[model samples]
Target: MELYRKTLTSATWWSLVIFNLLTFSSCKNQPESTVPSWKIKLIANSTSHVTYLVDLERAIDHILRVQLVQVPVFKGKELIVLQNIMALLDNFNPLYKYKKGKANIKNINRFIKSQTEVSQEYFKGLANDDEFATENYIGDDYIGCLGSQSGLRGFNCSLWNLFHYWTVQSSFSPELFQPGAVLWTLHGYVHHFMNCSECYLNFWFYVQEHQIEDVKTHDEEILWLWRAHNYFNRKLAGDVTEDPWFPKKQFPEDKYCRKCRWKGKWQNDKVLKYLKNIYSSISEVVGLINKEEEP
Candidate 1:
């Protein structure tokens, strides 16, 4: 009986592999030939969404408190890359709107920017800053990127949403950023600061495969991320770490945005419009900001 069970398990795993390969081959009509050149066995889905400002803020807090400070070696090019990331967040993170929050982030960014060298102390100190410690911005709650199961999704998921949020925010005010600035800075962060080694390798591979550096326009930057996100969705569909309640599906399912697709083919223009609408504003947080910003 033990031998039979082992054989059955092996067969089932192979079956899943074959099934996924067949699905990939069937997607010949996808807009981009997203045939990932390398395969890394880890869960990643760029479909992470940021519905509330708190979700993005929490993700940033996690990076500062958990990822950056824990870096085994925290100096040289790695330190500079993190500084650029903080600078981008200070300048454009939509969630950093209220005066106190804005001031806190700017101070952190400036500290890092002006430093020729930094230590884990800098990132650790950020967690204890008056505003960060007193405010509940990084509390243990999640709104947009929450997973059904505890370990299924959390920081990595919110991080993807944060990236999308940055792109959309940059689109609204292109003059505030150099072309591809946000994406390039994020690429550096993932390359140098992201704690997940496999995730970083795969992201780097995807960037190279897709020519992420070549993206130059605001609209292109937004769509580029959306496309890469969908590609990961396709790759990670039914992955073991996928939350059963949140089965990976190509984003903007017809129900969520009916015009996003037609006859099983994505309508890029409609999809772009849908993305802009959903990512451009955070209505839920506006009232909170109004209440908090009151003098």
Candidate 2:
């Protein structure tokens, strides 16, 4: 009877998971791809509508594709790459904290710790599996685009959202108040999961070239990533993989922050303030900031 009860509970849990995924995929502006839109929101923002981190939600193949751009960077380096991969998944990305619905687990920090271990075990297993390969990965061509299709933003769009959200929470929470945590986490995630050789090397070189780890404060952390992202955007300005609708440019462009620029240079202080509000832990724009700054 106990075994039967456990089986029934497992079935029920997965049913809810699928139902929730379907509901989110049905969202109005979902990109034209197999992955659902709510999944997009789920990965993008933890403070988003769905409470828990859908950590094991996407299939392993899909998750790896999102970070496959890191593969080439790890090409020649074996031991160091393995160590960093472990650190990234185990320490930095505590991503699977939403394992609930059956029991009322009060200790969230404890729950997060347990769930994170399970996720890291799974991540390592997927990375080592010999069967997975770039040719068969569900990536750019797999999630094909048809000229500005919203549903086809793929991993790049999802990654951008995740990084922005990271900045917001890392700045606000005392427990997670580390300055350059996200940058290191991102690098570690790429080294282990991504398979895209060229993109992998470029990002590795780019961040290393810019010394992303040197950021000492939360404000610099946020702005540093924003700057790096803009530089990458300029590189991919006319690339075939870019989404047509979401044209790449210097983020928080001049139109959004006229005061953020002087001549051709960005005013980092003003830009930091503007970004803080947009990516705050809560939806501060509507409830906190005045209308004059909503743009």
Candidate 3:
């Protein structure tokens, strides 16, 4: 009888221990600091305005044709995703009323192809047999040049703009965040299209290591990119490829978001809201960009 009682007591104790362990593991995922620890002072002297997106957009177009246009080796779904990226961005087409329907990748690419017209000689002297050279001469301009020196404010910077723009634009969509739409497309693009073999691996590993797939809401998606990109900015702060004009730093610092900074950590809520405004509707962004462009 004593043996039976002892066995029952031991079983109850083990069950309680197992239950506590499972609960702790589950809560480990609940809101923790997304950034690596570092002390950063906010810079408030300069503002990179919305028109920067205009330059960024131009740079992106140039980069795609130059560094990102190699024939992708991806098969099936990922290949399709890469092709349809412009279509995905179609949600923002109506925002720029002055030039409607211009952002569509297919429409613009087709027009360029018509103007320059692809020829065997075009790729004859290039590094990749399938290199796509555009009539606009977008080579190494970081997608599209706005008086930017050849490599300054190029591919990497433009890529950051593209990511931020998509999240902001997509966040307002009727679909709200389509789970992995933006992230998956980006993953596929970098993995298959980027020129440098080493770059693709680094980006791929970072995405896998971070919980990008765990992003269930569009808000989560935006914050995740913000966190990830700021990390990128911090790491690349002094690298040679870093743009001279746009020095990498912890973005949206005290100047950008006065409320985001506390004694040490960021107020994640304020940061998310601030990003949404920065990457807000097409009309708001286009209006500001146009205003900046005016004489």
TM-score of each: 0.73, 0.51, 0.60
What global local distance difference test value does model 2 have? Answer: 0.43
Output the worst ten-in-a-row residue range by lDDT, candidate 2. 1-10
Where does model 1 exceed 4 Å of error?
A: 1-50, 72-74, 97-99, 136-139, 197-206, 283-295
List the pairs of residues colliding in candidate 3: 58-143, 58-144, 59-142, 59-143, 59-144, 60-143, 61-143, 62-143, 63-143
Candidate 3: which stretches are off by over 4 Å? 1-45, 48-53, 67-69, 72-78, 94-96, 100-149, 174-177, 199-208, 281-295
**Candidate 2: which stretches are off by over 4 Å?**
1-147, 199-205, 281-295
User: For residues 37-117, could you state the per-residue lDDT of candidate 2 as single tens digits?
Assistant: 443333333332211122121222344434433344333232233333333233324232323211211222234333313
Candidate maximizing TM-score = 1
TM-score of 1: 0.73
Question: Which scores higher on lDDT, 2 or 3?
Answer: 3
In model 2, the number of clashes is 9
lDDT of each: 0.60, 0.43, 0.46
Name every residue pair that clashes in candidate 1. Answer: none
Among all candidates shown, the one with the greatest lDDT:
1
List model 3 lDDT by residue over 138-200, tens digit each: 122222212123434434454666667777677777363474456555554543344321232
Arranged by lDDT, best first: 1, 3, 2
Sorted on TM-score, best first, the list reads: 1, 3, 2
